[model samples]
Target: MKKLLAGTVAGLAMLAIPAQAQAQDAKGAIQVKLLGTAVLPDGKITEVKTDIVGLPAGTQTEANDNVVPTLAIEYFVSPNFSLETICCMTQHDVDAVSGLTGAELVSDAKLIPATVTAKYHFDLGGAKPYVGAGATYFLWVDVDPGEATLPLGVTKTDLSDEFGFVLQAGFDLPVNDSGLAFSVDAKRYFVGTTASWYAGDTLAIQTEHDLDPWVLSAGVAYRF
Candidate 1:
C-alpha cells in the first residue's frame, strides 16, 4: 500500500511540472486578438477652393463616426516588449458644409488604415498595462458623391492616400489560470488628405482635410 501511494504521488508531481512550464512559456509567445472597435472621427476639411456653381471658396467638410470589427497580431520579443500590427477597415460619410448657405452636401468613402506599433508592457500583478506608438498608412477608396451633391454639379471625388502617426494605450486582465485575458485599448491617429472634386472629367475643387480619429476597442487575447 505504501509503495502504491508513493508511485501515485510521483506521477502527479511529474504532471504538475509540465503544466507550470507551459504557463511560463506563454510569456514570449505570439498572440492574436479579435476586437470590436469604435472609430470616432474628428475630421475637418480646410483650404477649400471650388468653382462649382454656388459652392464658393472656404467650404468645409466633416466626417461621421463609424464602428468596425478589427484584428491584431502580436509577437512578444520578451515578457515586457512586443510588436503588434492591427488590421481593420472603416467607412465614413463625408459631408460638405457651406457656411454661406447653411447646407450640408453628403458623400461616402471607405478607409483602410494599416498600423504597426511597438509596445512596452508593465507588470502589475494580475494586470498588464501597455503603451505604444506607431505609424499608419491610410488607403481611401470608393469615394462616391451621392444624389445629394449631383444637383451641385459634382460628379465624383478622389482622395489621396496619406501617412500619419498613432499613439496607443491599453490594459489586459488575466481571466483565469490559462493564457486568456481581457483587453481594452485606445489609439489616436493623426491623419489628413488632399481631395479633388471632379465635374464630368474636369477638376472643380481642391481641398485639404485633417482626418484625426480616435479608436476604442475591447476584446479577448489568447497567448500561445
Candidate 2:
C-alpha cells in the first residue's frame, strides 16, 4: 500500500512541473514603446484662369519631410498573445518644390491604433525575439490647417479631417525577466482628405487627396 501511494505521488508531481512552466511562460504583463516616422507631403491644389478665358501654366507640387512621435501600451494575455494600443502625434511643414517661401503650414493630429495578435519568440539561447500582426483604428483630433499664402488668392485652405485604418507588425527584445524590454514596429496608415481653397470666405477650388503614411517605432517597456 505504501509503495502504491508513493508511486502515485511521484506521478502527480511530475505532471505538475510542466503545468507550472507553462503558467510561468503565459503570465500577463504590461509594456510601453516609442515610435518614429517620416511624414511625406502629398502636395497642394491651385486654381488659375487666363484674363480672356485661357488656362495659366507653371503649376508646381509642394512637398516636405516631417518627423512624427508616438507612444503605445500592450497587454499580454499569454506568452504568445497580446493586445496593443498606440497613440501618436504628427506635425508637417509645407513648401513648394521650387523653394517658394510661404506661410509654413502645420498639422497636429492624434492617432489611436488597437490590435490583437499572436507573437512567436525565437529561443536561440540569447536575446528573446518576437513578431506579431493586427489591425488599427486611427483617429485625428483637432486638425487645424492655416496657410501663409492662399492658393490663387484664396484665404483659407481646408485640409480634410481623416479617420482611417491601418495594418501593423512589430517585434520585441527583452532585456531581462523583470520586464525591461525594447521594441520596434512598422505600420501603414491610409488617409483621405478633401482640400479646398477659399478667398475671404469664398470657395475658389476643391479636390480630394490621399495621404499614405508609413510609421516606424522603437521604445522601451517595463513589465509589471
Candidate 3:
C-alpha cells in the first residue's frame, strides 16, 4: 500500500508540472493594481505669448510635485503582450522659481492624465519586466488663481487640455501561489500646456509651458 501511494503521488506531480507550464502561455488574463504615484513635472515657461502684467525679464516658473493614488488595469492579449490604462487625479501649484522666487503663480490646479499603453512583457526567471508606449490626454478639472496673482486683478485661470505621448517600463514579482504580486512602474511623459490668466474679458497672461513629468509608481497587483 505504501509503494502504491508513492507512485500515485509521483504521477500527480508530473501532471502538475506540465499544467503549470501551459498556464504561462494562457491568454485572457486580467491584472489590477492599486498604486501610489509621485508626479514630478517641469513647468518652465517656453514662450511668453502675452505678458501684460509687466513681468520681470528673467522670470521663470516651476510646478510643484504631487503624490496621489492611482489605479491601473491590464489585459493580456498574448503571453508577452498586454494593454493597460490608469486612472488618477493630481493637484499642483505653479510657483515662480528664478525671477520672483517663492511667489505663487497658480494654485490648486487639478489635472487628470488619461492614458493607455500597449506593453510587451519579458519573463526573466521569477520577475516579469515590461516596456510600453502610448497616448495621453491631459484634462484640467479645476484651477484657482494664486494669492499673488489675485492681487493683479486676476479673476480666472485656465490650462489647456493637451494630447501627448508616454513611455513606460516596469516589473512585477510574484509573492506566493496566489495571484498576488508586487509591481513597480516608471513613466516619462512628453506633454505641454498653455496657461492663461484672465481678468474679466482681458487676458492678463498667456504662457506656453513644457509640462513634461516623470510618474513613478509602486503597489500591489492581483491577477484574475
Candidate 4:
C-alpha cells in the first residue's frame, strides 16, 4: 500500500496536476487555500542513549508549540476522492520541563513537513467532511545548540529526520455560488526522532524523542 501510494504521488507530481474544487464543476477543478496552522509537539526523551553531561534526576523535556502560515492544494480525482498536500515551515525550541526548569536544550530548530494524503469525502449539502491518511517526512533544515548547552561545552546539536504516518480529518463549507469556502483541518502525526549533542569531536548526549505532533489548521479556500 505504501509503494502504491508513493507511486501515485510521484506520478501526480510528474504530471504537474493542479488542485480542483469540490463545489465547482465537480469533475475537474482546482483549489488554493491560505491557512493558519498550529503545531503542538511532544518532545519527551524516551530513552537516554548517551549522556556524558549527566542529566539531573527527574529531568524531562518539552518542545514549544508554534503557529505558522500554510498553503494547501487539493486535486479532486472525484467529488468523493481527492489528494491533498500542504506546504509550510515551522520552528520550535526544546527546554527542560521537570528538574531543570528554564534550561534550554534545543534552539531555533526549523522543520519542513513534506506530506501527501488520500482522502475520502462525504458530501452533505454545501459541506464536505473528509478523512485521510498519509505519509510525512520531517526535514530538519536548521537546528542550533541551546544556550544551556554552551556551558557544557556542547558544540553541535542535531535531530534525525524520519518518515512517519499521519491521520487527518477536515471539513469544507461553501459560502455561495462563487468558488469560496471555509476549511478546518486537523492531523495527528505519529513520529519520533533521535537527538544528539556533540562536544567537539566527542558525543555528549544522545536520546530518542517522541515527536508526535497535533497539527490544526483553519483558512479560506478559493476554487476554480
RMSD of each: 6.3, 5.0, 5.7, 11.4
Q: How does model 3 score by TM-score?
A: 0.89
lDDT for each residue of candidate 1 in 1-224, tens digit (9 for 90 to 100):
99999999999999999888777866547988889999988668766655556555556667789888999999988788899998898988777565533343445688899999999999999799999999999998678874556776887888889999999999989897677889999999999988777889888767788888999999998887
Encode model 4's per-residue lDDT on 15-132: one tens digit a residue: 6644433334463467788999999999998999998888998889999999999999998787688899999999999999987898999999999999999999998987889999
Best by TM-score, which number?
A: 3
C-alpha positional error of residue 14 in candidate 4 after TM-score superposition, expressed in Å:
36
lDDT of each: 0.83, 0.56, 0.94, 0.92
Off by over 4 Å in 2: 2-7, 26-28, 35-63, 96-131, 142-148, 151-153
Model 3 spans > 4 angstroms off: 1-24
Q: Count of backbone clashes for each model? A: 0, 2, 0, 3
Error of 3 at 28 (Å): 6.0
Model 2 lDDT per residue over 1-224, tens place: 99999999999999999999888766646766665655554555343321221112443345455676766777777665666776655555444343344544333333333334444545555555566555544344443444544334645555556566565666667788777777777666665556555667766545554555566666776766
Whole-model alpha-carbon lDDT for candidate 4: 0.92
User: What are the models' TM-scores?
Assistant: 0.82, 0.68, 0.89, 0.87
Candidate 2 residue-wise lDDT at 182: 77
Off by over 4 Å in 1: 1-28, 49-58, 97-106
